[model samples]
Target: MDIWKLGAIIWLFKSHVEGRAGIGKFLTSFVDNERKPTTVVFHGICWNNSVKLHVMKELSKAGIRSSQSMSKRTSLIDHTVLLLADLNCTGTDELIINASCIAQATQRELHRLPYRWLVLSDAPRSGRSSLWDPFLVDSELVLATVDGAGYTMTEVYKPSPTSPAILTPRGTFQHVLTDTRPHRELFRRRRDLMGVPLTITNTIQESNSSIYHLLQEDSLELEHDLISKNSYTLAKVAFLTLNATPVATFTNSFGYLQNGQWTGVIKELLEYNADIGTNVGMSQSRLKQVMFLDPLDNGRARFIFRQPALSVTANIFSLPFSPDVWIATGLSSFVAGVAYYLSTRLIKTRAEKGTVRDAYLLTMSALSQQGCEVQPRHVSARIVLWVVFTSMMALYAAYGANIVVLLQAPSTSVNSLATLAKSKLALGAADVNYNHFLFRASSDPVRNDIAKRVNSDKGPKAFYGLTEGVEKIRKGLFAFHSVVEPVYRQIDRTFQEKEKCDLMELDYIGYAAFHVPGSKKSPYLELLRVTFKRLREVGIKSAVNFRFEARRPSCKESIAMFSSVGITEMRPVLIFMAYGVALSVAVTAAELLVFHANRYRLRQRRVAVQLGRI
Candidate 1:
């Protein structure tokens, strides 16, 4: 019986050992096949206490071993997972736990497994660092903190892995802590001892499938790390607005609120950085940056950095799309008028009076001698003045003739109407001028006879000798017409030598008219008002009139005239005074006229009633 009992116990022991070895082999094969060796280490911590125990049991049962003791030796796990810490965690715990996990998971024989680590803090705050820190320093591992700590890796860590060892002050741990002349020196030293090159992986689980897969496996910790990194990046965006009131809000990668118009914000962002980064495509970046954030809000918010290529193209093309007639012609006319006025005034005052001494005066006197009065100077200067004027006029006329000869005056050319008539040049076959002349001649026999005599087929015969006599010039044919004072003065320079062909001064028929933009005030309007008043005082009637005369004798002749008899010209000096008077008079006169007419009619009815008493 004793021998049998011993045999049973030995047999059971052998079976248990063999079973454990089989499980170990299976676990090693599974880990090797599923989890490839990579620079990044990921781990998961179950939040439920029961779940944590179950996970540990499962790991042990699978023959995966846990470290027995902490050591400064490089042989250890590079990352770690701490489970079942309470949800209420502090910012410091978050930072420390993340750092420790990163160190443990990265531990290895090869260059200390690259010093990077990650912590899975399933609860809000777990004594993650308190539990993991001991393991981290013992293994001579570098750490990384991942949490909502609102701090960067460089801010909370004493030593950054990027610095040199000589500059780094030796501390109880591998990292350094020191106070150098330059504050950065301490940081630089710490960085050297503890810093490790790290690449951040921001996980994004946008779909339920991805989330389900992550929750099902231990590697789901990767998703959490990605989300943390993504959140951190989003927090860096700046906010701005045009008005004090919030128009709209935009979220950056860090989820910060920016208020303003989208276009404005995008423009500002573009000026800062041309490229946004790798995650967002150019089109998506443009949509995020250029599109309106809060379209329904009163204030608009936008992301400014990226803009559509079409928008840029449209902006460039839109600049030259406005009406610019003012610059092309209106402004030109205004400038030209001002220049001409200034030049004419300067010539009249300086050159004409000074250099051309008495030349103008002589011409005026000559005009007066020919029946147009020289008023205010007749008997006072008489004979002596006449003699000096006459001699000067002759000299001036001779000078003009010499200049004309040198320039080959238009009157001598075939282009001249008078020259063509004398040569009896056949007018162009279908010329309107020829038909018009024939029609006029046929309609008026007396005029036709005169025209025929004057237009005889002769070689350079004078049509009419230069004489101071008024004559009626045919329409579209004759060079001179009835004389009017203003017209005569205007044309005198052109026809001084040929009095018979000179245009005569007739009664003022029309005034120069100008049109201005109906919606806006113009400087020209003011000048026109001033000028019209001066002209009216000189007996120039500017009322609208239409003259109708027969082109042929058989046609009827008629004229219709309409005058602005009630409209008074406004004087420059009395603009304000005149405006007031005109308004009052117009209103008062209308009222008085209506009232008086009514009273008169009433009186007549009353008189008729008294007579009807019989």
Candidate 2:
């Protein structure tokens, strides 16, 4: 006896020992009930399914038509007796629910209560399965008002609440949507593979990847959008059952970091330990190690680095021009000043002959927007002044417009893998092998550099998972290399509308697929291949990918705030200004010291000559 069943049996029989609802009372309530139901339905806890089915058979004396299949019993229902067997609930209760029929079946009244009128659960109410298993379509059950200890739940069911499921739940609910004309319990028929189970390895217990659809939250099971879940569901509908085991490594194409006997998920498949591996990333390299089914979802190997920190350099003035442009501007102005001085031929009469002070003032005043104290009398000098003045006016207008834009909506620097690599920010991969994996596959030097740049923490402490790597990414200056779906989950949660721009991604290096370990010789490999093509074509796998993709688009949220620009946003500009002012003050002080020192030295030399003459 498995411990879970033993424990469940102890609790189920507890009511009998306590003189609560016994087998006799349980029998009395079922056969001669007020609402005599012809058909009963059993589902939810499957471990108890075999024993529960036997009990139902004896109660009805082989006369009552019963089924665990929702599709099979749909036609047989009317003033329906819905025996919600293995319903993990506290005690028992008589309940009423309105089931709206499809465009075909009219409205039906469904009533539910245990035959025993007691606690038949494997565990207490706190430990019951959160949501009912199997698809409950177009059916809204309000079990708020019920009698005694029984199942009561307001179930608006579809595995995960898709966007449309929120408003309307109208859809064909059955194990097999296609296959037979007016599909019978034909989906129930399974092929005999000598009772072979699809022995599978997955992190269904811990990972909330949504790929496995194993998330439990707010009493909702399989909460997140999942591709793996759809694949699993389709396989079951195709008469393929999976017996799963939990594992850490989904697959190990790159084994540079991972080691030991318990290696890759592929190892299990290769060893014939697991017939199938769910959530396996498909790669040509991995394909060599073990075979894969048709691709379920091909996730690219991309890097999700921390959004680059906001820039702090404030060179708004210089940004509009390159160094070459500035040099040309200064040279042009100096040449015009020289031309004005020489063209006037004023050096012979000018007191400040050596300085060309008048010519300098002429151009400087025009640039500064102040009228010159002295204007050139020569026609050629006036022409030069006019030309220089006009050019300065045009430049001033252009500079002003650009500077205003800089102060308003600042443009972000380009983000890329090469840029991240050049930066002080180091890289970390969720899986250590991924770095080595990419480098070998990519011959491009830039990609090689990008792959090698993965920060191994200078030791063996490479991030073994995405969650740990993401925490470092959040802190800043860390690029995490992983796939889209997991990274998108973090991006959706951690980033704000404004910070979406901060989220960065690169193209996938390679596509990964769900695989079962085998060569072309394996019979099961072909079975999975056909299923994959059919599932993907019908959009079962694609829908999950599309939903997640729609949820996370390229950042549209404004990084620029709605309010006026704050000092933080202008951090770079302010820092630049402060440096410029300090440099200007220092230069001015140095020039003043040199001028005064030269004058003092000249006076001392003249005094010495006078003393010598005296």
Candidate 3:
């Protein structure tokens, strides 16, 4: 038999001979009678049938569920305690390989490893060359080791990469095989690290360029991107509260799944190179690989632009009156024109010899409050003209008053995503990784149409930098989709106070927050969460955000400033005048052609008569 097997046999014999409950008394203390018993999973090559059977019987007596193998579908609640049956047979190298395999299986099944360990051998000591580095590095766990005679208990955790796992002795049962000594709490959920060093990874894009570097400056103001600066502040504050010395590492990306492998900060975490990844998004794919802490900021990307002029959404000339009012006005004008023509025929005066065209011209002149050469000779004709002029004066005044307000008003038509997609505004997006993904990958038809408009020419020109995108927003009739905080910072710098009043934003990606991510099964998860929550409650998070995200500029100037009429507002009047000029030119050309045709026909008749006489 192996040394572990021999030791186990001796241990059992001693316990039975001493009339002690052996492993049962220690195991029962971990269970609460009111709740379900804690589960114990045992797996190793060292377990023979007799040894396994004996341990199983003891576990059953303690009211704990003991399993030799773990199912892939096991719940995380079932991962209470993991027992490595015989670790003494394998040296440090063998122990590492075996533990790595077990960790992989546990992570695959529960997405995290167990925090409590029960080892049958005392091979894993707290040393620099310990085999427990891979699993216990930067993590906290309850460790209990048993030899033939007795067992020793300790809480094992590592604070930094340079330091070895610190083992705090809890209890020891050496002389007696087992006793009714109460089991003290193993994992007490510690928050303060007492100024331990930690590796924190983050990304810093420099000079609005794609290249990224580690943050060299300690000051937040020196950072170009507001998001990067804000994240740095929050991370610094939270870690400092926990009394940890953070060693910062900068990567080019937050992390992305590239070629079936994670790159950047995420890779650092998976390889145990980083303890915390700052300024990370809790995207679905990322959550599968890393455990995200509580959200720091509820960030959102949106379509932001200036509100378009009313003329862009509808015909400004027609907006002066409703359809019913316009119809009534047109009918009244036509009736007045016809009435004047009929009155002229009835009166039969010198100025009353009016054609249908003359009657309509006189009607238009009166409606415009202009004088015409034609005069009414009789009472009936005079009465008809007076009535038509009086009614038109009131209608004209109302129309002019409404036109003044319509010219200055902003259009609210493109308020929703559906309307925005149907609007005539030129669309563009910030040239970033996630924006490209969202625009192209969305299955909604409205989102697809918006994507098509942004990629209208099917080229790269539609994507712009933050500076360029904000500039386009200021120029009017252009909408840009981008992250809110960074874009607002540019707006605050470049946009005028009056222009800020017209600025509008529509949500693109819903308001999901970004969080600080750490490696899965990190021992510091709860402590970090508590610190962040406390920071947010104390308004530190808000204070940090204020430095990065520019608040919407005040609209004080909007109340007193006058909007000047632009070419867009004057287009309808220009088109009307052009039509009138074209009509007059066509009439002149027609009259000249008619006069020449008549003269030619008259000359031809005279020549025919002269030839006949000859």
Candidate 4:
């Protein structure tokens, strides 16, 4: 039978326990015909909270009740002895049965609630056994008090070959936090301990900003002031020891039923190989895997493309309207010319024989936005001409104003996703981006077309890296799809203001993030939940991001060094200028042809008159 077990014994004293100490130790015994003691102080710590509940159940069945000390003043006076393990112990308790012992917490202060104590037959040194830390008296001290008075220590445990050694439950025992400084307790459980070492994974080592590099310092050292780098970095701080591996990837479909099987970090967690999953995108499908805690960050996948540079020496007047509008105006001028010939040729009009040619020139001049040279003498022709001239005057004035505006402000390269998709430029996306999958699966025809374009042979070749994609975009006639943060960082580090000014990014895809545990049964998952919540309340997480951010791109005008009146910005104006010049040349050619024909007719009439007289 266990030495600490109750045995058939009796307590002679039924009197009240009234003394100087109120709760002292040694020779306090109450026994039955069992193997264990009638009074026992069950050991406890934060990590052992769940196990402690079970021990309480076992104690109750043994016909004994244990003492509980929640706060510092929770009345250990109810029992005869307390297993007081003090974090700041400088006290002593002697084992009267055999040896005198010095407790690590000999000198008690205001209270001994936080202090953890151990009593033994004798103090054991460090090397002989991994179980015992020998600064305290490791005695199997049991107690039974009378009334609200001093209690007695019922049993003492001494180590020997014949006697079984009393053991502290390692699995249930929580670690005593060395730092007693108070905090918001948002990320920490009310009573929980670092029960065991855990395995965790992170992104592969390619950059310093990756989760792997951020958590390196914490993984190497155990006791230091916690400095968080990111959400996952802060999560790592909760564990005193972690076996971190490089396997965390941006997985959105980890636990989802994929082709009748499951994959990703969630699988490793389920199998108990990894304790926590980092930087996993949150989704309803993934929630079925383990569990998702707080988000690491929020971000979007969008298009980043080169912006067209500003133009110079533009035919600013013509830019107010489109090419189609200009074409319609020219066709209207031809119709007006035909109308004048019909309205005047049969009416015996007051105009001269060259009136047909003059009318055509006048119509052309009106459409070109110039003053007409011919004046009409007939009322019907005059009305048609004046109406055309008035409309032309309003158009001319508007074009002049718009030209001034164009000269002051430049145009953009691509204004929207629709423009980018319709453009002949090569489009690409980083092979690792999960949004590509979402885009390809889009129901919208425009988005579907864009996805097909990117995956096509004329688009970006498959599996190109972000750096390569960025290089292609910088060369112009190219666009890339990626998350904003990483691409923003690269541009911040690489591009000048002039180069980055025209670059435009469009937001199209956003995803929710989550941190997952190895299994639903993981005890530490609760600690993670609490810690994650605390981190947010403390303002460690902001709307933009959780950590370091890059400066946005900016620039002054005339930074391109050399540019021109680019066709992209001055298309309408240039087309109008060309149309006006062509019309003027044609009008001049018509006048010369008419003048020569009129001279030939007069010469022929004179020769006929001379022949008749002979």
Candidate 2, 466-490: lDDT as tens digits:
5677677666566677655666676
Candidate 1 per-residue lDDT, tens place, 1-614, comes to 99999999999866644533332232233233224332221233222344334444545655454322223334343332111122123453453344343334432221222232222222322222243332311122222222232111221221222322221111111122222223422222222222222211122322234333323323332212222222112211110110111111122231111364232223333332211211221233344442211101011111001111121112222222234732443353344334333433454432222222233343444433443233213332344345545654664465446533322211222233333334322221111121222223333454344345434444332222112211212211233221122123223333323232312121111212111100011111122223334433543322110010111111122122111211121122256668879999998999999999999999999999999996
RMSD of candidate 4 to true structure, Å: 15.7
Q: Kindly report which residue stretches of model 4 are placed more than 4 angstroms away from their true locations once superposed.
A: 1-192, 205-212, 215-231, 237-259, 306-360, 363-425, 433-447, 457-463, 475-477, 507-519, 542-547, 554-563, 567-614
lDDT value for model 3: 0.68
Pick by TM-score: which candidate is best? Answer: 3
lDDT of each: 0.29, 0.48, 0.68, 0.49
lDDT by residue (tens digit), candidate 3, 33-113: 214445666655354556566666877876678777654534455446554444554452454334544433543222224
Q: Backbone clashes in each candidate structure, one number apiece?
A: 38, 13, 0, 39
Candidate 1: lDDT over CA atoms? Answer: 0.29
User: How good is model 2 by TM-score?
Assistant: 0.50
Estimate the TM-score of every prediction. 0.15, 0.50, 0.71, 0.49
lDDT by residue (134-250, candidate 4, tens digit) is 212112332222222322122222232232333321111111112222442312212223234445544332333444445453332111111213434555554432222222333
